[model samples]
Target: MSDSKSKRLRDPVHGLIVFAETEPLDLLAWELIDTPEFQRLRRIRQLGVSKFTFPGATHTRFAHSVGVFDNARTLTKVISREMKRNEQIFDAPRSEVAIIAALLHDLGHGPFSHTFEGVQESRGVKKRHETWTADIIRNPNGSIRGLLERYRVGFCEEVAKLLEAEDPQDIYHAVVSSSFDADRLDYLRRDKLMTGTGAGAIDFDWLIDNVRVAEIDIGAPEDDEPVNKVSTFCLASKALPAAEQFLLARYTLHQQVYFHKATRCAEHMIGKLLRSISTVANNGKNVEKMTGLRKEHPLIRFFGKNGECVENYLALDDTVIMGSLNALTAASDKTISEVADRLCNRRLYKTLDVADVGHDDGKKRQRQRTITRDFEAEIKAGSVMIDEKASISIYSEIGGDDDRTHKKLHILDGGKPVEISRLSDIIKALEKKEQFTRFYFEKEEDREKAQRKKGQNHD
Candidate 1:
């Protein structure tokens, strides 16, 4: 790539995204961005169906990917400088791998982003978007994999491994997927700016500036030989408040934007539309036969016998799903057409927060579960269709499942390392369980019917 070929692009959320030929990593990133796989991100919305709620949230994954890459570059520079100051070696290849992983993190998201993943999950498909991302990165014929291979012997594999890391203590791994990772930092800031939410006011610049690599004990016995010390990311004691603010911002964003009631309803409706299309397409029925539409549906091949080929997966995007939905509005099948029409016209399903409707303490919580299940059964058996959508838990625990666990973020207090919860009561309180299960109905009358059934159960 020539210097002329590498140009800086202006971004609304992240200012200037520079691609300089002088910097090897930037040149490589530019090459990767030029490939078809990365370019496909331009067609996938960062927040699926969120535009229905927040008009300005039509930003694509392409922009988010570039923002993440820029954030990763900053984080890497900070960590590398700190390492050099401490007379430690900062591996350039490892840094490059982290940046590339951050850039391609959402590469395999299907049309409408997580909405398609939800549909796949409902169909008993265990493979998540991350799995597809890994597959795309490792696919020999994939443009991304080929580009990475030209950069280094095992560059592609290293990037995939970094993304697949489950260890909470690995600083490099955390940089790409932790609670305070580049991905979170970019998305929080970007989403807030685009949605006009004004909810995520995180001191990201202060937090990043205060980040330092520290050797902390991984909770091993003090007397153990060679002491189980690991190099992890930590915040200065003075910046502890900033970290708390970040967590609060994330929680608020989840509540106010990501998990907004209307957005969730739209997501559920799209999932239903996809499910209906896949069912009809896979049952030896063509789109023309089912919908009488003489258009080339992008989903036909993928939903056919050989389920989800690389070519089919690569060809899918938001436009394809939107086009299919437009065609389905006239589908011969009433269910398919109705669902598609609802999604197209923004007639989102009505949602009822079941968690707030009933109260059960202790082991009696089983009663709440019973009531919810009974309500679902009643609705399913009635003249209306409903889908149960649960909000992902936003709680941050000291040691919990997956990457979002709070154990990843450490704080240095009086030169002693401790979890952020130990330093801030606000953060500790944020760890409390906060999740809700919402029942979605296709029609207002159905929602009323479900509400009456809930009242009868309570009575």
Candidate 2:
């Protein structure tokens, strides 16, 4: 938060990402990043439990957030240049909001990243990181709001709106949330480097040079075509190959790194651990004695009604969670004790693929639920044998460009705006959805596990 000096963050991905005193936006980002809430991200792993599989994947959300700021600023510069080239007046305030939004995007993530989120989701509580992010930025109780108010009245509101916007209101908005947004652009390269996987690599420089701004129509075909249209960020048709590689790289990472068996197994155990803790604590009895964790534990503040607020949400991070696991290994609850023991000892559960081509996603989920109900008692540490259905579609008309949900990435082919999928068969080939299911087992001596039971039933 120093006023007179420039700042530089040495990043492995972007190298020498700087916050210059000369640039007002850079100074703003510097102040925001200097805040304790923002620094808390340093204790939250970006790749979460993926570190178990790829020991090199220890990167934190703090660095990723900064890298995102760098990516977003670079993007705005490109758009600003385009605006100058076309004789359109640049929207400086809007660009500032984009850069700020990108910097603050992941501020609310909890311990172990998405794995902690999965814990809440399992308990029928849908607490999303994005919702927490909105709270941290605009909630009067938080210090980030005060910083924004000091900078300019109502600047915080503009950032929150863009972060939560359902549609791309402008190119600046698209820079933060579109399929080709700064977050994805930074993470793909960053994660590939951190995880030491050479497969999910994309020509980022070529993609950046090829991307340009254009007007695009929105809405899926069967849902009604072109209900709305607006000018936003899009790639030039010549950059189709680079875009294809980006999507394919993302797809490759999901299969190889994100969805690795040990990582998912560890995540499943954590989910069970959290559910048991919440169940015991919410019952309103001597929770500390029951769980063998402290009465003043960070997670204790996070599990009950207190978790809905930003203050308690910020109190938990990777170090706190992982550090507490050791004490939790001695919990009075047998399930908690065992799961913590496994996590601490690195005795990860085994996995079996439960994907079904014959059964649709809904039916497949229902089957797993029935199996979970019958077998979860013996699980000792996980929700069920089978993990939740993980579905990824590399090409979708929903996102801008042939990506996930947002406006499709548009390309001006023959001087007319066309969805990128229409012009590239490589991207079009990925339109089919890919679904994967896996069941985890603790050991042979324990009661029959998910995959073992499913196998016996089939026999």
Task: Please write out the lDDT profile of model 2 over residues 1-459, one tens digit for every residue.
Answer: 535688888988899987888887788888888888899999998888888899999999999999999999999998898899779999998898899999999997888767777778877878677778888898787779988878889999998888877666887888887767898889889888988887745998998897787777665556555466667777777877777788788877877888777888887787778878888766757777778788778787677654556787888898887898889887888888888888888887766565542456665656566556666675444534666556656643211244433545567687676776688887677667766676677764433444445433421
Deviation of model 2 at 279, angstroms = 1.3
| Clash pairs detected, candidate 1 | none
Candidate 1, lDDT over the whole model: 0.74
The most accurate candidate by lDDT is 2
Mark the regions of model 2 whose C-alpha exceeds 4 Å error after superposition: 1-3, 220-226, 305-307, 355-383, 395-407, 445-459
Question: lDDT at 66 for candidate 2?
Answer: 95
Task: List the global CA lDDT of all models.
Answer: 0.74, 0.77
TM-score of 2: 0.89
The global Cα lDDT (0 to 1) of model 2 is 0.77
Q: Please, what is the TM-score per model?
A: 0.89, 0.89
